[model samples]
Target: MNIADVDTPAVLIDLDRVEANLKRTQDYADAHGVRLRPHIKTHKLPRFAKRQIELGAIGITVQKLGEAEVMADAGIADIFLPYNILGASKLARLQALNERVTIRVTADSAETVAGLSEAFAGAEKPLEVLVECDTGMGRCGVQSPQAAVELAKVIAGSPGLSFAGLMTYPAAGKYAEAARWLAEGKRLLEEAGLPAKIISNGGTPDLWHAHEAEVATEHRPGTYIYMDRYQVEKGVATLDDCALTVIATVVSRPTETRAVIDAGSKALTSDTLGLTGFGHVLGYPGAVITSLSEEHGTIDLSASDKKPKIGEKLRIVPNHCCVVSNLFDVVNLTQGEAVVETVPVAARGRVD
Candidate 1:
């Protein structure tokens, strides 16, 4: 079908751009001898996950158990869950997921380790657990290298768990510091007679710097699959590199410099990412998505002399693409203005 025939406030994925992004990232990783186990949170589609593997990704990463289950059922054999699984119900689900795929998990606290042990104590095969380190991001990881070693020991001694390695989500522009921290953790682990099998760190913000951390064996990049406004602003990707764009129709031309689009928080999402506006309106460089109501997006066209007429269609690159992916049940795949296909976002509401 022609792109013009599609409805407004629609999610569009450029098939050519998606294919290029996948191959570019995988090629970069392969050249550096770094494994690409892409995080599935961005696309959340089994087809893209399989494509990543076909392009040489060792495995895939999922933030939630629901996502892992979806990918596992889709025949993705190797998966990584970088978050700590606590509650008994979640642990049971994780165990069930592990039964079908070769899955690894991460833990930052002894409490999480204990829970993992209790759940997998009598299992046939032990679960591989990685020690999550703070490494300057100051998120969900151990504070120091010593703490990482101690946690590794706890994981190794657990009945149904094995120490996999170290993992961290480093601060955006601080790759060197994070690398030193991981290096220390690696040294400590080796000295303690528990050498790490995998030292991993990831963030799309500092993707090109992955090689700086020589201690890392693999890298996880999620947003690279669908470049967004945030990625473009960070200079990590160019506007042409983005594969996802929301096609919204102009619904109002209120005054001289003001216009409204059909896309709003419900469709375009309300993620600013510290940017001055909500999203970038393609073909309207002067337009700024000033504000968004539940069903309306206010655009300030004051920067440009021209004004969009009511009912005019516009393509928008959202501030954050990952969140936008979940806002829609399905996304349209297009090849140069032709709507080739539409696929369900398999892991959209998989928040568990």
Candidate 2:
């Protein structure tokens, strides 16, 4: 089917570009002597995740247990869930998933370790847990290297938990600081007779600098598969590297400088990522996605005299591709202007 024949507000994935991205990232990891555990949160497709493993990815990373379950069912043996899994119901499901595949998770506190130990205690295989350190992201991680070592010790002592090593999501361009934090934590663990086995650090923005963190043995990058406007703006990727775009049709031409498309926040997402607009129109060099409501995207044509007329079609590169992938139920895999296949987003809305 031709891309033009597809319905409006549809997500288009350039298959060729996707393959290129996969190869480039894998090659970089291989050359650096670091393991590549591509995060599946961006694409959330079993086909892509499987392809990543086939292309030398040591494993795949999922933020939630629901996503991990989907990947495991698809024959992905090695899955790493970096988020802390809490609650009895969630832990029960996590235990069930662990039985099906090799799983590793992260912990930042003694309470989290206690819960994990209780959930997996007496199991045939102990669960692997990593100490999550907050180098600078200031998110859900231990604030200091000492805290990290303490957590690691707790995991090592827990009956059902094994201290796998350290993990961190450092702020952009802070690779050195993150490495120092992980190194210190590792040193302390070794001094206490507990040697860290795996040190994982990840962020798409600092992916190229992964080797700078000498303590890290693996890197997890989610958005590198299908970069968006934010990555482009941050110099992490070029426009030619982006593999996904939203195809929208002009539905209204309200004024000379104003036009509307069928895609809205529901389709394109509302995350601007501090950008001035929502997305970048592909062919329209100066067009700006001024605003996005529930079902309509307003475009500003003030920068250029040429404006989109009613019924015209346009492709938009969203500011954030990960959220946009979750917003859609299916994505069209395209080669040039032809749609080769439609893939279901199997892990969408699996927040639990």
Candidate 3:
């Protein structure tokens, strides 16, 4: 089918742009001599994850056990669960997943590590554990480098747990600071006779700056595969680098300057991050999405000489592509203007 034949508010991925983004990121990591474990949370499709691995990614990073399970079932051998795995039910799932593949999980608490060790004791394989450090995000991680080292030591001494590395998701422009923090933690761990080989840090905004940090052995960048408005707003990627967009039809021209499309928060998500609006209109670079409802995207194009009329189609790049990917069940893989194939968002909404 042609591009115009597709339904409205459909997810479209430009394959040429995606290949370029993957090669660029993988080449950057190769030149820097660091492992690239591109996070699969951004594009939860197994085909994309396998493509990333084929393009020199050491493995894939997942945010939850459910996502990891999906990837593992799809034959992805090396997987990293960056979130702290808790609860008996989740631990049992993790244990089973560990038996299937090389699974690594993150934990910053002694209690979590102890619990995992007990749950996975003699489970046919040792679970690699990384101490999640709070470099500055103020999220779920240890407060300081020394604190991270303490947690690492606990996991190292545990029966079924092996200290794999130190992991953190620092805010943008905080790479230098996070690098120092991880270096300090590695020093302390070494001084205490504990393992601290891998220092994994991830965030789309800091992917380019990953090599600047001397201690980061592996970088996990998910959105680099499909750049979006959030990455563009943060100066991480350019508009041409963005691979995904929602194709919508201009259903109404309410005013000369404002037009409404059939794409809304349900299609593009309501994630702005204090930015302009839902997304940016392609070709009409000056046009901005001012407002959105469940099925309407209000675009402000008062100054444009080429205003879109009713029934016209417009491609909108979402503010956050990851969330947009989760909202859709399938994405039309396109090359230039031709619709190639529709790939299912296999792991969409697998957030458990």
Candidate 4:
């Protein structure tokens, strides 16, 4: 079926671009001698994850246990969850998942390690735990190199946990700082006779410069598979590099300078990521997605002389592709301008 025949407010992925993105990033990782563990958060499809693995990805990174479970059920043997997994109920799920796949988790504190220890205790194989370092992201991670070493020690000493190494989601443009932080942590670990097996650091913005980290043995980049407007704005990817777009039909042309599309926050996502507009209108280059309601996307066509009329369709490159993927239950897999198949988002709403 042609993409044009699909209903409005549909998610579309270009197969060619997806293949290109995968090959390019995997080749980059190969050339640098670093393991590419592409995160499945961007495209929650097992098919894509398998494709990534086929293209040379050592494993797939998932943010939640639910996503890991879905991938594991799909025959993905190696999986990594880079978030702190807590609670007895969630640990029970994690334990079950660990039995099914080679699961590795990230922890930033002794408390989290203690919890993981109890969950994987007396298991056939100890769960690998990576000490999350706060290189510069200021998110969920240990504050300093010393804290990272301390946590690594805790993991190494834990009965059911094996210390994997250091992992960090560094802030954009902070690769050097992140490298130094990880290197120091590795040094302290060595001095203390603890092995730092994997130093993983990643972000699409710093993907190309991943090798510069010098200490990272693996890189996890999610959005590189489906470049978006934010990645384009960050100069990490170009417009032609974007593989995913929201196909919306112009439902109203209230004025020459104002138009509305069927896509809204529900479809086009509300995250601007400090961008000027909601998304980049493909055909209408000058149009700005001014606002988004539940079911409508308001576009300001004041900058363009040629505005979209009622019933016209426009493909939009969203600001953040990962969040957009979570909002849809299915995505149209297209080859060029034709919709080849509609694949269910296997890990949608797997937040828990």
Candidate 5:
């Protein structure tokens, strides 16, 4: 089917651009001797995950068990579940998944560590655990390198848990500091007779700066597959590198300065994240997405001389691609203006 024939408010992935982005990111990681584990949370489609792995990604990083399961079930052998695993049921599932593939998870607490170790005691292979350091993200990791070392020591001594390495999600611009902290943690661990082999750090904003830091041996960049408004706003990627967009039909032109499209909060998401609005229009450079409802996206098109007529299609690049992807069960794959195929967002809404 032609792209124009497809339904409005549909997510489209440009095949050529996506392949180029995958190659660029993968080549950069290979050149620097750092393993690239492109996070599948951004795209969620198994076909894209296979493409990334074929492009030289060491493995894939998943935020939750469901994402991991989707990838694993699709024949992805090496998987990393970066989030801390808790609860008896989740641990049991992780242990079961370990029997089929190489599964690794993060930990920041002794109680959680003990729980995982106890749960996976009889597994065929030890559950690989990485000490999660906060590194200024202030989110889910432990605060200090000393604390990370302590956790590593505990994991080393645990029966079913093995200290795989140190992991972190560094805050933007904190790459150098995070690298230092991770390096320190590794040194302390080695000195204490516990060696850390995998020092993993993840963040799309800090991808370029990953090599500058010494200890980061692997990177987990999810959003690079579909560069969005946030990455463009932060200058992480240029407009040319953006591969995904919401194709919306201009359904309303009530005023001379504003036009409304059929994509909105449910389509683009409400993640401004210091940006001006929900998304940005490609051809209409200066126009801003002023307002968004569940089924409508309002754009201020007064600055441009050309106006979108009723039924005209326009592509809207979302601010946060990850969240926007989760809202849809499938996305249309296209080449230029031609529709290639429709791929399901296999891991969408798989929060578990």
Candidate 6:
């Protein structure tokens, strides 16, 4: 399909850039001797996950049980979930999923561990559980090393759970401190005779410094596959590195300095990620995406030396590419200007 033939407010994934992003990150993991178990929350495509494994990923990581089921159906054998899963409904599904693939999960509390233990108690194999540690991100992890080891002991002694290791998603730019915290947790685990098997640390904001977290045996980076404006602002990716972009048509030129595009918050997303604008206008370096409603994105073309006229198309690099993937059902894969293939987002709403 030609680029012009495709409808406006569509997502475009550059095939060339995708390959470069995959190989570059994989090579870094290889050189650093750390396993690259990429998180699939970014692309959520089975094909891309398979490509990641082909490039040398240890396995794939999913943030939700529903996502794991989708990938498992696609023949992805191993998956690591880095969220604290609970509730009987989700646990029942987790049991069914565990029967089909190798799975590891993280827990920050005893209640979560109990649920996992009960779900896999009579299974043929024990479920491996990692104690989620909050080195500094302050999201969903145990606060201190002592707390981590205590949870590890609880998991190890559980009916159907084995303490695998420690996992954390630290605050960006504070990996060194997070490492120190994780290292202490590792030391305590060792002293307690429970050797950690996987020290997992991840975040795309500090992709290049992933190796510096020496305690982490595996890294889970999701956004590197389709770099976004947030990654660019953080200096983790350049605009050229961005593989995903929103193609929107200029609908109305309300004024000489203002224009409206078909893509809006539903396409470009409202996640500013601390940036000034919603997204970066690809060609109009000076253009600012001032505001976005559900179906309209207001563009301030005054700053731009050149502006698009009515009926012209604009490409926007969203603030967060992962969220954008969930909004679109299909993403057009293109090489240059020709749309080579378009695929459904297999796990689009598998956010259970």
lDDT of 5: 0.89
List TM-scores for all candidates, in order. Answer: 0.98, 0.98, 0.97, 0.98, 0.98, 0.99
Query: Over 4 Å off in model 5, which ranges?
Result: none
Once fitted onto the true fold, the runs of candidate 2 whose alpha carbons sit more than 4 angstroms away are none
Count of clashing residue pairs in every prediction: 0, 0, 0, 0, 0, 0
On residues 1-352, what C-alpha lDDT tens digit does candidate 5 reach at each position? 9888989889999899899888888888888887888898899988888989998888899999988888999999999998779898898789879999899999999998989989977776999999889998899888898899888888888988789999998887777888888888988888988888899986788887767876887899999999998999899898888899999999999999989999989999988988888888989887789989999999998787888899999988889999989998889999988998998889999979
Error (Å) of candidate 1 at residue 7 is 0.7
lDDT of 2 by residue, 1-352 (tens): 9999999999999999899998998898889887889999999999999999999999999998889989988899999999888899999988998898999999988888999999999888899999888999889899988888878888988998999998999886677988998899989889988888989897788888887788898999989999999999998899999999999999999889999999999999999888999999988879999999989999999996678879988999999999999999999999998999999999987897
Of 2 and 4, the candidate ranking higher by lDDT: 4
Q: Per-residue alpha-carbon lDDT of model 3 for 127-213, expressed as tens digits?
A: 899999988888889999889878887888899878998999986567788888988998888888885777888777888887887
Q: After superposing candidate 3, which stretches have Cα over 4 Å from the reference?
A: none
Clashes of 5: 0
Per-residue CA lDDT of model 6 for 1-352, tens digit only, reads: 8887889899999999999999999999899897898999999999999999999998999999989999999999999998888999998888888888999999999999989998889988888899999887878899999999999999999998889999999897778999999999999989999999999987788788999989899999999999999999999999999999999999999899998999999998889988998999988999999999999999898888897999999898999999999999999999999999999999998869
Worst 10 residues of 2 by lDDT: 203-212
In candidate 4, what are the lDDT values of residues 36-99, reduced to their tens digit? 8999999999999999999999999999998999999999999989989899999999889888
Report lDDT (CA) for all predictions: 0.92, 0.91, 0.88, 0.92, 0.89, 0.92
**What's the lDDT for residue 342 in model 1?**
89
- Who is ahead in lDDT, 1 or 2? 1
Reference-based lDDT, residue 72, model 1: 90
